[model samples]
Target: MEELLQQLAGKLGIATRFSDGGLVRKDYEVDDAVVRYIAERLGYKAGNRGEVEKSLADFEKRRWQQTLENIYVVEQGKLQFDAVVPAEQAQSFFALQIENKDTGIRSEVAFEVHPTDETYTIGKTIYVKLLVAITNELPVGYYNLTFTVADKTYKSTLAVAPCRCYENPALADGKIWGYALQLYSLRSERNWGVGDFTDLGNFIRMCARCGADIIGLNPLNVLVHSFPENASPYSSISRLFLNPIYIDVEAVPEFKPEDLSEIADKIAELRQSELIDYAEVYPLKISVLEKLYGRFMADRGSDRRNEFRAFVEAQGDDLHKLALFQTLYDIKSTYIWGGWTAWEDEFQNPNSPAVRKFAEEYADRIRFFKYLQFEADRQFKQASAVVAECGLKVGLYRDLAVGVGKDSAELWSDNDLFIRDVGAGAPPDAFFPAGQKWCLGAFNPYVLKERCYEPFIKILRANMNAAGALRIDHVMGLMRLYIIPDNGDAGTYVMYNFKDMLNIVAIESCRNKCQIVGESIGNVPEGFLETLAEKNIYALSVLWAERKDAGWGDFNAPGEYPEKAFMSVGTHDMAPLRMWWFGYDIELMHSLGLMDEAAKNDTYHKREIDRWKLLSALDANGCWPEDNLRKDNYIYGQGYPEGIEEAVHRFAAKTASKVFLAQLEDILHVEKMQNLPGTDKEHPNWRRKLPVTLEKLEGDIAYIRNIQAIRRER
Candidate 1:
């Protein structure tokens, strides 16, 4: 026991104390063993000794609890787990390694591998070969292997021998070959007040027509069934599973005609509404789904049941544990921000036998949760396939939020990884005078470095597997995060190391084969854009933000913007061009305190003149005669006159950016912003539904032609 403690202490590079009372390194002394262990884990050879030593020394000096916050170090092709330790306790350790004798070198580590073939048939066994390079020689022994691929986990064994190749044929192609992202309310039809898989599949078919290769969706991570307030997908209760709300109740095999009729009136009520009311829809859908589940159980030998079982098995123990946790969470009704340490002593210790026994007792509930995820995955894949059949190049580019909720599954499962005391947010910037304090907990820098960034890799794979392209919200976070210390004000925070973070991001991007779009909109550090460019990650160019000055202007000129970017007029957070032009109410703006009376008057007058000039130019083109223009219709509101949508689109089309994204709202001529910043219930945010249904949207000739024209020119 003393020897084991010494070895661990040496490897951890910290002073070790055995149960019998023995110490390896002094409390304040540098732990060489721990440093060596970290260095080896990071794949740095003797050549990097000096740098590793320096880093260890720095770690000791900086006693910040959140040391390895968001740092990613991939060694031997695998992300290293965080190796946090007191600087004085740095030390060295050894890992059993397997080398390839044929090459007389270490085998390459395998992070992830994708199928070379673009398409495959269902029920066909396919073999995919992976190459891994090991960094050290190891004693002959057997090792257990655990890997997650395509939302499925596979565990196996590898015998220590000289081998360069690791082949996995078990991960063969399935019936669903594509991935789709839920556009949420962006879809046209069959959305029971909110976008569901039905609408997603229809959109996928449209993508097929457009020649799109793959589709990606936002994190479909599950949320509590009853909570409609938490709209962000990243703040999920379980990262290992899927959100049940996305389930297409009618599509379930067990759904009966009579059950459907029972909910017909409720369903009809939902169809008439535009915005998604999850509180109402979720309950109604769940009631119908429960009925379906009963039928599914009755027909045990059915194909759907078998599929569900396979999915449950594939997800393994993780899903079961999370589901149980969710059940517990609901029953206890604990506050999200309340520290987990405060949970009843029995519930707090996740690994205790008692908890395990409890989880087993509630196995049925766990299975149900797993069943929902499996179905959601199936529907999402089918939707993606529909998109691939379309003609779009990148079918569904999903967005990944910067961090998860503090009380999320990630925090619960890996409490040590996140700093519960501190919150992650943005520093004071021009857009926001007060530093933003997002409630999400950030990974401790020190802890992350000690662990070698395994958590980040998990997140990356989750988003990458099903995406053709990924929009990293607040891409600048990869470089530096503003971490507000626990028990501190929003302004009390520090920055994390940037270079290390970028390296991991670059590697992940290469491995995924998915285009990366960094949302580098605000408070960007110097040379950050250049760095992202060098890494082959594209930038996000908003038409509103592309002007030479902060004021709005014609920004589509080629020389003005980066060529490799996704150009958009506005996003979900901003007002639609039409709304900004025609409906900028001064009273509302004043009430929101966006501007003072004097400043508002001056700005309003300047914008009115600018609108007149633009309208005059349009009238000169004879598109609309000067006399034909109705003064009332063209009246200036807060900023611009009506009829600015055409100009905005034209400007966006002409930009140097390779990809152009016309907001669904703009296309449908929606008047309201999907969400408003600063205020929540005061405004109708994420709740507004699209005015037109999916069927109507498809038949909207004008809308189709306009988008087609833009794409044609691109």
Candidate 2:
């Protein structure tokens, strides 16, 4: 396996070794057959050894050709033009011109060392400086550079970057607090079935009244809701647009009681269920949206019509493409397409003549989707405005899911930017021994560079446009991603130019004046956090995940947490505080077949010890009465105990971390987690609702106490 893997590794440009400590190299273990399978999967044809070797050589040549494209992207400033002058042609000269791709603004830049300069050396690369442009004249954005070196002309990219990323003044104070919530799980009477912007706005007021400064939400990325069962927000279709599911139809200005009378009862029935009925809610919401659209088009006054027109114009090609994609998706899924990849060729080609005709024929439907995104943005903006009006410092901190599924609108629209056949995920780690395959397509590094990273920039801008902050989920993807060949379960790492990516984040964050937080959890590579910290991006410190400084490696103390971190008792992926404390999650995992009997028993034993350690720490800190930690009370009892959740939250709040987030599950003391990482139909992920509605939270004793406890600790 080793010799075969090594042989195939070089042929495929994949590393067969990795380093964890020192500079020592280690051999990897990918079966030779596996690489052969991947090579064929990527459309390489070879029946014999010689043919396979030839194909591998051809692949390497293609990679080299792409690398030598001569496109260089530099931060905005004095443009530098570099060229080589032969010793015989030392007196040759060149001219440099930079033009803004979007704005059509052009400038002439001088080279640092011209060919006629006394110091210019023949056969040496000489750097020519272009005169620096005024910052006001040249805004922070992408530009095109055209260089003329004798008979040769070359084109490249020049991007202007802001000094540093934005960090909200309030969050920088080292003691602001927030509520972390899975937005869908929030129950409210005003929304259709799942939580909506209306609920978020109302909750913002409640949070402010309770002295909270920020409200963290789960990823709002658009999910493939046509198939309601797999509704993991992380596994979304498009991050560039908002999810239509979050639209509050009743809150629309054009919504009239008569318009939705036919479906009012269905909406009511949806709210009555404990678990969110996504299947029912999707169709009902669409019906309401259609009615609203009809009402909108009935009286398209110049003022309103122009507003929608301006939005469509500003959103540009991306929005129009997304609309067409959604329109075709709805049509084909409802009528023609059956299994995956069964869609016709024209459907696969987003810009085909047949597709263009279908789009023209279904223009109204396309506009409907476009309006859905506009409305979603409008309501979200209104919610953020409310937060600002209520005197909150940092509000609506949104999470950006790491990547999108392989078969998604974004990938379909911009297929070249994403790699197909292979899925992106994690390598082997403590929590996931076999590694994880997220079944998501990764951004093709080569295409991103060739395209000047417009796709990623668009995604970042869309996410940061309305929120006070952005939390990048699985933040490590910016650095390197694990790609599983042929969508299989295990994979190897693919490196990216993360430094430049981080710089872009800084530029966007500064432009928006929003702080950034990276979810740097579980098995992060060394120097990853340092890289994030250097960019002034905050870190997350899940209390349970932080290991003790000494002894048996129990949970760490709040004081030990970093000042640049957001301290939390638990995250959405893990069990709620009470569930973890009571061992309910472990038992649930066993029941769900996630663990065997032996593993369950061993886990429970470890859980008991960790519980004891937690109690001792809490007792030592005077968070709870020491009498609660008596040996007699520490037996095989793993039931929910009074005040433990609050104490756990208090421990988190007391951390030196600047931002402390109290999750909704801990506030409600819910046993079930919002998501089970690797499950689909086996659990009700993202479908669980709060035990009580938003209205009830204002008066519930336990809820109120939890709020006060967090505030007091903060």
Candidate 3:
């Protein structure tokens, strides 16, 4: 039974044992309950020994019967693959036709198969291996391959990809410096309340004028529109679309703020609030969006109307799914049903007749949602244009979140693409001792292969659109995910086809002309970083995580950093330099009840040591002020050190990395973290607004001097 369980789990991509985040290999004992649940999910028999054995035999038979996989990823110059065929057809000629999906060009080649000794038998029929080589050279792109062997037709997707992801030619000239910040955190006097695409454009103009090459942004993926307070960009409703809330309502054609003047006082109050009230902001923006949408529908000009139509047509089914999902959520909100999972079975199924009727009834309302996306896309393109206009090498480096929310529109649209019951998260690590259950869904590896990775390809294309670069959050997910089943206590690992996924990423990167950055921060598997570097996918190196011990200890000096990396002072999850140097994060965690008295005491002690070590490292790198090593500064830990923030920025800028990004919060010495990983509502995670407005930030003497110092250091 144990052996059978192992075989079944292996076939299902479930790791029998895995290396944890701590770099310790732990054997996962086969749990009967876990195995049973997984088997049932994968449509395998786990009732008894006899049934399990039979299921295994059937799976093996099916595997051997298939002549070709659903897809194959090959290098641009290597188009050779192995195929299985009936023994009698081994010596027959095979006709292969490859059609480029983009160009609609087809190439034909006839090749005689070279049979190998490897053979498999099912009943009376025998299958033999054939080495099929194509002489026709194909460029880097996706192609539809049709193979005919003795009148038998076999179809598969052939992805010819570059050996490595796209690397910006500017990098070869010299390393570049940039700023990373959450777009929503921007405080702009002109914005309605929350930061919008217009704010992004203003920021680009400011940073580009400062000689910046890139601007890193938090994920702009769409979230729950009605329940906007669930505002973790990392846990979005759909990665395929942009957040409409970030749309500049005033920028929308035909918008008239005076027409809605009654809410002027409310908008003023929201704009002045320190933390964003997404609940208030979402409704306000939606109200204005609805008005603009209505006006456009009533009196849009031919050119503009045709543009919207073209966008809708270009977006096609994905746009339809997103709009339909939003429309259904709007209607379901009347009853306040728990989620799509709790909806009536008829409504839950996207293709059900009942859903079709609901969609037809709310077709106009659905169009309203599509209009929002269109405006958001248009504004994003406008903002991205500023990168070139300002002479920035890489403008608007967008982020792609690791996974979608559990009950998101993405899950509602396609059930087979994801494993609904199991949740994706991280294993226990130094950052979070209890581990984390992200409450996010994991994609089914089997389903991805079956679909020729169409879902993944679409997601990359969507996020890569209108961007100079894309950062893949928790990029280890391309190799494996920590999947915790609903019925299991501790989750296990599920491996993916890493090479194939990387190849596809490379192909998309070249196609979009966008560089790739992989955030492989925690619990990364062995050789993962090296593989990413080899593929030219820049590694994300957080200053806090670059210590010699990989913990709170001595830091790796500036010159020791990787050349092919995007280094930063810290990430959104970590405290800014000011907060870290003062042990404010520990105090905040304790105050929020995330840490006990004992843990807080220990953490504070460690933080003091970390601070001292950080100063020492900076001093050694010649980035720290001469007075920072004074006895008074180290002994009292009183009155925030003035030059430390600049010193930290200097330290990061001097790293060997090809790209260095200073967090806006760190540069401005903001004490609050953009996100506190463990807490949700308990802490103001993603709601904190920047202290200064865009106009003030650009003109502030201190900010300008800091940028100048960084420029000189780099």
lDDT of each: 0.57, 0.75, 0.85
Q: After superposition, how far is residue 307 of candidate 3 from its true place, in Å?
A: 1.1
Highest TM-score among the candidates is held by which one?
3
Query: lDDT-based ranking, best first?
Result: 3, 2, 1
lDDT of 1 by residue, 26-61 (tens): 112223443233333333322244654554444333
The best candidate in terms of lDDT: 3
Model 3, residue 383: C-alpha shift (Å): 1.0
lDDT of 2 by residue, 1-714 (tens): 444334545554454444322223333465455555545544454445776766765664454333124444344453332344344433445566779877898987545444433223213433222222333335666678776656766677767665456778876665889899888888987777899988888899999888898888888988775676567888778898888888888888788888766777887888878899899898888877888888788886757667888999999888898888778778788866442256887778788899899988999999999989888988888877888799888888899999988768888888767766788876665456677878788887766876778788889988987788899988988887777886366566666777668877887888788889998654466788887887789898877767764334766667788898777787888898777877888888889999999999999998888877887778777777765666347535634557887777777788889988888888887888888877778888889899889988989888888877787887
Q: What lDDT score goes with residue 601 in model 2?
A: 94
* lDDT for 20 (candidate 2): 27
After superposing candidate 2 on the true structure, give the runs of residues whose Cα lies further than 4 Å from its correct spot: 1-13, 19-27, 32-91, 97-141, 162-164, 335-340, 487-490, 549-552
Where is the poorest 10-residue window by lDDT in model 3? 23-32
* Candidate 3 segments whose C-alpha is farther than 4 A from its true place: 23-30, 110-112, 430-434
